[model samples]
Target: MAQTTAVSSTHRLWIGAQAWALRRLSAFSRAPRTAPHLETGTRGEREALFHLRRLGYTIVAHRWRTPKLRGDVDLVAGHGHTLCIVEVKTRTRRDAVPAELAVDPDKQRILRRLARAYLHRLPPRAREAPVRFDVISIYLESSPTSTPAPSIQLNIELNQGAFGWA
Candidate 1:
């Protein structure tokens, strides 16, 4: 009986070690890949935030999403009496499509719907404010390699009122 008890204890220890190793392996596999394209997009969003601040726009939310909503508003800001819903686009020089051209009519329609949903969640003071959609396009220089530390040049363009609520 004592031998059987010892064997059972050893079995439990082995199973625990296996589970711990599996969890570690899964976490390592799920680590985010620092791909250049993704990095460029993140950098563009940061640039847009800085630009908006410099222009005296008060940012109310970043990447705001509602539980029941299908889409998210990248940046919700206010400048004086108008509230702005911003969409950010990032592209490298090697990309065939221009950033501005990427936001087609369908995309605009989706953004407008998202903005409406966002407004519904705001207080009456903000809900009644006039709203507009803006697009920020960032063009980056093509890098020679996919190295994570490559230096790149960025040209940012702000298109205010790119689309309207109506």
Candidate 2:
């Protein structure tokens, strides 16, 4: 049990390290702010991506930044049959507002626009491939453990094969 706890702690720290590296790279590229919320979002995205992989998704791209949209797709993935363009939104808790509600209709529209642009960039065959838009919400309901407080659970929901668009 002690070993298991140690391993879990190590894994969390490693995840933090990975986020730190990404933040550093983005900084070097002269990107915008790397606030704690950004780190939290990135971390949540990574966790969501891992869950998708475990459930049989092949990640093709990540953090695909664009100028016109000025946004990012947390993960571009495929699940054997259809290409999945995923939007990840992370929240620390589910208080009056839930995590899934963060991706508003306007945000979905932006995602659709970017998804079309992404499809246009592919070859004809690839462009014609079946595609889907999905939203993965990562709800982290725990406080930082530099100190101890209450326990928080993580919830990852994949709105798989989300068919409609704005």
Candidate 3:
């Protein structure tokens, strides 16, 4: 009976430690506040990370940028044998258009260039792997005035192979 109690106490301590680690990780991952729009985008990226993990993706990088590049990739994930370069767009309810539509031709061109730069830095074998571009559009619905701000609803749309190489 004493041995069983000791095991139970050890399990509880392990679970508590896991919870504490998760809390610290979350706090560290949170972006600093800036413009409201940037904050919304940061929140959307967090949401996207959760959504993709739920869908069985292994996220390799977040906000990946090279010293030679001016822009950054929102997320890099692996699905099967494909390397996905993702772009995340977040907008509030006030926006009339779908956020994915924001990745216009000019943006696609820039993303392709960045992708090339990313692949060039990889090992030759890894660089030969298939590549795909994806876009995640997140629409945040404002809560009712009576409801707390933390309860905002998110509508996320994932567009795989959103565009081809330029």
Which candidate gets the maximum lDDT versus the true structure? 3
Best-first order by TM-score: 3, 2, 1
Worst 10 residues of 3 by lDDT: 1-10
- Which of the two candidates, 2 or 3, achieves a greater lDDT against the reference? 3
Which is the better candidate, 1 or 3, if ranked by lDDT?
A: 3
lDDT of 1: 0.74
lDDT per prediction?
Answer: 0.74, 0.74, 0.80
Tally clashing residue pairs in candidate 1: 0
Could you estimate the TM-score for every candidate?
Answer: 0.71, 0.72, 0.78
Scored against the true structure, residue 45 in model 1 reaches a CA lDDT of 74
Candidate 2 residue-pair clash tally: 0
On a 0 to 100 scale, what is the lDDT of residue 119 in model 1? 81
Candidate 3 TM-score, true structure as reference: 0.78
Off by over 4 Å in 1: 1-31, 94-97, 142-150
lDDT tens digits by residue: candidate 3, 56-131:
5678999999888678999999877788999999888746678899999988888898899999989999998889
Better of 2 and 3 by TM-score: 3
Worst 10 residues of 2 by lDDT: 1-10
Off by over 4 Å in 2: 1-33, 143-152
